[model samples]
Target: MRVVLTTWGSRGDVEPLAGLAVALRGLGAETVVCAPGDDDFVELLARAGVAHMPLGPTVRSVVAGPKPPGAAAAFKLAPELVAARFETLARAAEDGCDAILATGLMPAGARDVADKLGVRYVLACFHLLGLPSQFSAPGRRPGTPSPEGETDNRKLWQQDAERVNALYGPALNEHRAAIGLPPVDNVRDYVFTGSPWLAADPVLLPSEGMTDLDVVQTGAWILPDDRPLPDGLEAFLDAGAPPVYVGFGSMAAYAPKDIAGVAIEAARKHGRRVVLASGWAGLSAIDDGGDCFVVGEVNQQALFRRVAAVVHHGGAGTTTTSARAGVAQVVVPQIADQPSWAARTAELGIGVAHEGSTPTVDSLSAALATALDPQMRARAEAVATTIRPDGAAVAARMLLDGASAAA
Candidate 1:
């Protein structure tokens, strides 16, 4: 069987699909990934031994570019990108594919491609909040009004749908028209099928209040990481008690103005060493101290196991990785589904959610102190033991089984 897994946005968006692609390959299925042409994504897919077909420029170029465009400017380019995405995925699956699975925004194009080829299109989501749930709120935008009661939440969701429609609906319909497909009335409903697969660790995140949405929770799509830590990092880990691991994976727009001093000071207050990841923000150690270590992208699955606690931007991938490693966490959420992840972490008693994105030395120290507590660490370890590691395999089997049944 052959599969094409397409994704966009940050590394977090690409990693899960890459894991699924690897799992498909392991089951003797040819898999190709359509992702952004970012070098980081290229390196990640290469390491996983998956075939990568670039769709367009990486999110880095658009978000962190020297002349980053405003919302209106970026929206102006959406139609072309939507059209390009449809063209790219169609080509990737031209050789005949069993399934085309897509995640991230603008999946309607992928759906159209699948319709054109008479193949099944599988829509997968990493965050549970993306789906409609009376229990939880929708993925919050940067400055939207918070919903109050159940009625308010429902209205908020409807409002959110309107926002999505106004933003991407026109472009989506334009592409559909170009391909002789009928325009969709509800963009959100069109992208989110009647049933969508939820790729998240069930132990850490479970679907609730799923009214009309029949979500298939296939656990988190996590790739097994065997890459050894860099020599310098390994030496640092060997030299001291596991440091408090701090890194906001790939939140380019989540610019926490002074994360360096805040995180380092907070960790130091707890008498813990620090391992700082210089993500897109270019965070670095402020002082020349041997107790601190600075690093670029490394293996979180391996590194989290050695850390005393994990502090991050509460991305789905990072949250799951830290939970699986059985380490306590402190999540400083900036936007989107991050606040939800942070809330879940705190609810599970395995971590503390920093009040807001910008953390002061004292605020982060308090959060770290809570996470460093022995009881919380114990709960994290217990939860880790229950986290299933076969989400990719389960999803792969489901795809192949569907193809077999159809045949």
Candidate 2:
């Protein structure tokens, strides 16, 4: 069997697809990943021994660039993203693969590509937001209309579909016309299809908001990381009681500008050292203190094991990693889906969900105080024992079995 897995957005978005590709390979199938052409993603795919096909421009430029009017950039990029994926997925599967599995809001091209190739097309999501639900209001994609103060789920979804149509319909039809496919009327349903795969830990993040769809809840697809911590980082870990960890991952720019120094001070207040990740936010030491160490692209799977508590922007990958490591967490949510992760952590009794992204020393210190509690740490460890690590293998088997039956 052969497969093409495609995804866009931050590292969190692409990593799951990479994991699935690796799983497929382990099962004796050919797999390739079509992802953003960033150097980070390229290196990641290389490490996984998967072929890569670049889609669209570097994501760093978009996130790092100055904010456009609210959703302006997201709106502008939607059509372009579909068109690029339309061409790239086709080229990636030119040799004729069995399926195209994609993650992210923009997968019209992948769907159409699979349709044209007469292969399976699967839409997978990392979170529970986009799928329609009467149980909860849907999250608005960037540049989509927000039903401010809206309570009705049906009305909110109607507006959501309209935005998907308005933002992507014309460009999608244009690409479809060129590909000799009929123009779709409801682009939203055309992409979401009937059964979308939810690649989240079912225990941690339940398959919620699925009134119209039969959502398949696969566990979180985590890229296997076995790299040892760098020598300096290991030395720091050994030198002190496991320090509080602080990093916002991709949301650094949007997070409070002073979060780094504040988080350091907050950890210090609890008489703990700190291991800071210089992620996209480019965090650094607040002072020349020996208690703080700043690192770059280190091994999270390894580092999380020794950390006393985690402070983060509540990214799905970081949140899941912390959960898997059995470490207490304090999630300071910055944007969409983050607040939900924060709530999950708090609800699980494993950590404190700091109300918002902007954390002051007092706020973070208070949150850390709760997260570092012995009881909370025990809960974290208990939860960690149940986080399934077979999501990729599960997804791979499903894809191959479905394709074989169809054939």
Candidate 3:
């Protein structure tokens, strides 16, 4: 069977799909990794030995550039944002895959192709972005919206239903009409994984407004076991009591040098060593930095094991990694779901969430000190032990089962 998986976003988004592809491959499925429009990520996939098909340059332009002015008001202005993705997915669907899977970002395109081919497709989500049931995690009230202002659970549920209807509803009908297949009545025709409603086994997840059935918690898609650690990472491990790992993936520091200086000072204040991830985002070193090392990408899994504390922008991938690593953290959330993850971390006793706006040296120093506390460290590790590896094999089996059931 052939499984075509589609997704979009940054490395965090693309890399997990890669894990899914590898998992599907192990299940004896010929996998085709199709992402909306990210030529930039093509090399990374190639390096990982994954087959890929890029959608279109226009999709790339839209995702990479700033959101079109007033996109919220005029969806037409951002055709590529919601509408033009079908053209890209359709172009890819001509190959005639057996099953298509889509991430939350590009469901329309996946739905269009699945309807055309009369094949089954599934929607996989890494997190409960705005789903109704997602609000039940902890500080949630029924019928109330997320306190974060991005969405209210009540409004988001209605909006999600409407968004799917207005965006994917018509495209799917047109594709079905051309292919002589009847249109679906509701958006639920597309199967969903990682939501609680359809999960075979109960997992700890929010339980408020979630309504979709046919859901399965495929576990968190994470890096495979074979990804080798970066060279010389061992030296850093030996340098001191596992240093605090700090670096915001993809988000460039406004002033790496200044940030580095501040970070070094903070680490010194807390009497800890620091390993700064020197990624595309410029992160500099401190002027007084004696032993602080600014290095490039290291195997996150391997590196996380060697760290006592993790300080990062609360990305989903990073949050899972830190939790699984059993390390305390000082979360300095930048935007979007980062704050949510940060807040969750603090509430769960993984560590203290940095308060206020931008992460300053003084605040970071204090957070780091708290994270290093013995009780906090023990709690974080205990939580990590419970964070069962969302087994890749299980998710792989589910994908294969979906295809086999369709047959």
Q: After aligning candidate 2 to the native by TM-score, how far in Å is the CA of 77 from where it should be?
A: 0.6
lDDT of 2: 0.87
Per-candidate clashes come to 1, 0, 10
Positional deviation of residue 255's Cα in model 3 after best superposition, in angstroms: 10
Q: Worst lDDT window (10 residues) for model 3?
A: 196-205
TM-scores for all predictions: 0.94, 0.97, 0.79
Q: Pick the candidate with the highest TM-score.
A: 2
Task: Give the runs in model 2 whose Cα sits over 4 Å from its true position.
Answer: 142-150, 208-211
lDDT per residue as tens, model 3, 1-407: 88787776556677778877877777787877776445446866776677887753423344323332233432442234334445656656676677777774535556666766777767776655444444433222122333365555555555455555554566556655665766765553343433422211122233234543334565677656556665566675786777878887755432223556676778888778888886545676755554676777567887787887888877777888888888888887765557777888888888778885465688778888899998998998898777646555677787788778887
lDDT of 1: 0.84
Candidate 2 per-residue lDDT over residues 1-407, each given as its tens digit: 88999988889998888889889998999988888998888998898888999998778877865452257776778888988989899898988799889887567678998988899888998887777888887775655567568788889888888888888899999999998999998888889888999899988898755457988988889889999889998899999799999988876457666888999999999999999888877888978999999998878998999999999888899999999999999999887788999999999998899976688899889999899999999999999999999999999999999878766
* Position 255, candidate 1: lDDT: 57
